[model samples]
Target: MTKDELKQRICESVDRRRSQIEGIGDQIMVNPELGFKEFETAKLVANTMEEFGFQTETGLARTGVKAVLKGKNPGPTVALIGELDSLGVADHPMVNPETGAAHACGHNAQIAGLMGAMMAIADTQAGEELAGNVVFLAVPAEEYVEVEFRRDLVKGGEITLLGGKCELIKQGHFDDIDVAMMIHTHSDSTMKKTGVSTSSNGFVSKLIRFVGRAAHSGGSPHLGINALNAAQIAINAMHAQRETFRDSDAIRVHPIITKGGDIVNVVPAEVTMETYVRGRTKEAILDANAKVDRALRAGAMAVGAKVEIETLPGYMPLANDATMVDMFEQNSEELFGEDELTKVGHRTGSTDMGDVSHLIPAIHPMMAGASGPGHSRDWHISDKEMGYLGPAKSLAMMAVDLLYGDAEGAKAVMENHDPLMSKEEYLAFQEGVFRTEVYDGETGTSEVES
Candidate 1:
């Protein structure tokens, strides 16, 4: 069959499984789980992939899952990825009361669309006419959260990196994959139905703690050193550095105090905080991160308290492959028209996909299917057709266009693309970013963690 004919058959197959596809998306929406611990979600994804006759692997990077569909001939390998974790949005309507995990960012749709593509590709037997393999990856922990728990896991040697994709890459899960692609749900009403940015911001995380002497709140309060006061001052200092940040760098620093005190009647002796210093480039992120560290130390110095800061490598700046972006746009236009193909130049948010983009040609685009700001309680899937079925047919068709016959499309992408870093360099840089230090306010001394 011709390439176009194969694509048409794939789309038809996706349409035939519309109910099942939508059900998968809806079912996940209610059963949301957090990153690196998505056992329930992994089970569901693995079972679905196995039923479709794909060779599946589970328990990767804690809770990641993957499956491969090989073509009649051997050539380049393409990865279709989906995040299998949710964020904490306690007030969301679909939140899990037991865990406070909610699908507020529309990750549920990513997996749903991924499954739809898998179903269509397999049902149509498109691999028979192709010259490459399709790898379906359900990765965990795209959202860099639960810092304390993840840090403990790292210290325990249960995992090395905090982000799921970073850990997967460290474990060489993507070694065989030639290219990768994933779609995120867009909540901005101003954006078109779909879009792809040329690039996006990267970030590094800081886990902070302020130590002070405790005292009875209603008694001799003068005997207490207020740790909360130090935390507040540090937040203000971080804000003060914002004006110094270059607009071209697109710097963003947002910190939240995770703990205040033990009891309302007692003066708090310890305060813990977490934040990410995000920017468009590695230099920019590091520059801003250093300034944040200085500000945290300033807080402790002023209060005569102690401060501990732990720095963790977050993600690399996303540089989407130009050729891959064009192919995705072309296939999306063919399937859903060009009206929703908005030209998104650069995004401020970050994702682990950026890490993969550094080592191979990768694309992380967006499709309009939800309303309300992402990660907010109001965020949810609004258009089932465009949200669920849109990516389904688009991904399947893109794969057909890339791997059909001699696989010229996939070949051109790899040939024209230049990776930002080798796998070894990427691993070394990420590992170097992990460190901890303590500053003693009274002694004006700092000690680095071994």
Candidate 2:
């Protein structure tokens, strides 16, 4: 069959299962689960893949699900990804009270759209005409929250890396995939029905703690070193460094105090804080991270307190493959229409897909379907057609365009794409970011590997 004919058949099949697709999205929205803990969501994805005669694998990187649809002959493997975890928005109407998890980021729509594409391709039996495999990936833990819990998981030997895609890469999950693509549902009004960006930022997470001797506030305030004061000093110092950050790097450092003290009546002996240092490039992120760490140490030194800083690896900067993006843009116009695609500049936000992009050719485009501020209580899929079926058609059409005939489209994309980092290099860089340093202010001493 012609490429357009195959895409048409897949789109028809997706349209036929419109109601089912909508239901899946809606059901998942109200029962959201947090990252690494997305058991139910993973189960649903695995069952759905099984229904389409694809033997699925679960428990990948804790709650990831993966299945492949083999074509008539293999040329290049393309991954169509869907994030399985939800943001922790306790106040959201559709939130799961037990988990404080909500689909406020439109991850539910991602899964629904992904399943729609998978169903359409499977239902139409387009694999016979295609030349490469299609990998449907339901990845978990895209949102980098619950850092403490994730750290505990790491210490327990449950998982080494934090982000789902990062951990999966460490586990060798993407070894067979040549290219990766996923559509993120956006609630922004400025976006068109579809949008692609040149790049996005990456980040590293820090868990900081200040320790001091506790003493009665009223009786012996002079005897106790206030940890809260140290934390406040660190925050202000970080703000001061903001002026030094280069605007071209798009550096961002925002810290929050997770714990102040045990009781207000006593001098604060412990203060815990968390922050993410994000930037458009790895070098920028590391530079900002070092400045933040210096500020933390300065704060502890000023107050004669002890500061413990733990740095963990986050996502890498995203570099969307040019050829793959061109293919997606073309398929989007053919499926939706011309004059509807949106071209955007580099984004400052971070995602695990960035890590995958550094390892292989990848695209993380946004599809306009949801409404309301992202990760907020009011965010939801506002347009069923655009939110549910648009991605389905767009993703499937892109796959068809790439895998049809001898798969020249996929070949061209791979030929033109040069991965930003080798797998070993990426892994080493991330592992190197893992560190713990304890600075004692009283003796002016800090211990680390240097």
lDDT of 1 by residue, 44-80 (tens): 9999999998878899999999999999999999999
Give the least accurate 10-residue stretch of model 1, judged by summed lDDT: 335-344
Local error of candidate 2 at residue 89 (angstroms): 0.7
What lDDT does model 1 reach?
A: 0.91
- Candidate 2 per-residue lDDT over residues 154-176, each given as its tens digit: 99999989999999999999999
**Poorly placed runs, candidate 1 (over 4 Å):** none
Cα-based TM-score, every candidate: 0.98, 0.98
Q: Least lDDT summed over 10 consecutive residues: which range in candidate 2?
A: 441-450
Which ranges in model 2 have alpha carbons more than 4 Å from their true place?
A: none
User: What TM-score does model 1 achieve against the real structure?
Assistant: 0.98
User: In angstroms, how far off is 405's CA in candidate 1?
Assistant: 1.5
lDDT at 434, model 1: 89
The alpha-carbon deviation from the true structure for residue 86 of candidate 1, after best TM-score superposition, in angstroms, is 0.7
